[model samples]
Target: MKQLFSPRADRLLRGFGIIGAAALVLAATVGFALSRSDGTWGVGTPAAQPIPFSHAIHAGQIGLDCRYCHAGVEQAADAGMPTAETCLGCHSQVWNVSAQFAPLQTALALGRPVTWSSVHRLPEHVRFQHAAHIGAGVTCAQCHGPVETMARTVKTETQSMGWCLDCHREATPQSASLVAASHAQFGVEVPPLANCSTCHR
Candidate 1:
């Protein structure tokens, strides 16, 4: 019985242990490499507007603030689109009858809301507050890209949970100036946080 149990069994066990460790190392290496990719992120396709409005003209040349159109981005969960009146306030005289603005004209005459689609749509499971980001001094450019420069807006940031958390982790006192600017601009506190409930329901 003593002879039956030998050093060979110990050697065999050690060999199996080495093989298992190697497999784990290989798997982890591959997984980490794959994680670096932007898997399942949106193609960032530009949503077709009912009317082709130039953000460049409004926000760039004209110097209209983001809050001018998205009136609620700094104070609410949903960044509300500008009302029909808000649009017509300027367009009623600016480009009142341009072919490009025909859709807007139709919406006005119909007395209906302009059906503008979202550029960066989040998942229903995820509850994002535009106020939090806006308060935290996150610029529209940070998430929406250089919308002021875009003729047709497209997705710029991944808006992924990991990406959001990364920002939270990096928030420091050095960036306090931005938060102050945002607060001054929006009249809301821009606290940097990485709390789970910040986004998730």
Candidate 2:
């Protein structure tokens, strides 16, 4: 048999394979870091709403509660958006003649709700209930930040899975069973805070 292969060729092939694997690992690490960055999650970026409603003026200065506009925050899965009628209830007495009130008035007359942009949104797979968190003694500022001081509502926290998990890990024992009662149907003891089923359902 003839010596068809050279030793140098085998060495070069091994070197290239090692370099390729190293490059792949580096790329994957960088990509994961970027994905977890605040810029990627739009943290601190204000969403543009149809109306420039100032939480600073309403909540901070006037001392309006979080539940005033988001009425269902205490009892529903969703923190409900305030109806146009809700805005007009007070603006109808104050800024009724201002040009800024035009859109609100029109929405009220048309019986259509004003579509406001959401500041903090989670993935569809994540099942978060505002009422449960509120009932557990978590304040609006905890997840939403100091919203009362913001002129334009922005996402203060990343609201990422890891971020949520960190809070759950540190939660008091009394507040730990966020969904334990609901998960009773599973027939097995479910770890309340850190379980995938607790939030993924």
RMSD of 2: 4.0
Tens digit of per-residue lDDT, candidate 2, span 1-201: 775658898788889999999999999999999999899999988887878899999999999988888999999999999888888788887656688777787787898888788867788999888887888888988888899999999988899898989987666435434543334434764446766777887
The whole-model C-alpha lDDT of candidate 2 against the native structure comes to 0.83
> What is the clash count of model 1?
1
**Per-candidate TM-score against the hidden true structure:** 0.65, 0.76
* Cα shift from native, residue 68, model 2 (Å): 1.4
> Which runs in model 2 stand beyond 4 Å of their true positions?
1-29, 93-96, 172-190
Q: Evaluate residue 123 in candidate 2 and report its C-alpha lDDT on the 0 to 100 scale.
A: 80
Itemize residue pairs with steric clashes in candidate 1. Answer: 135-190
Tell me how far the alpha carbon of residue 178 in candidate 2 is from the true structure, in angstroms, after superposition.
5.7
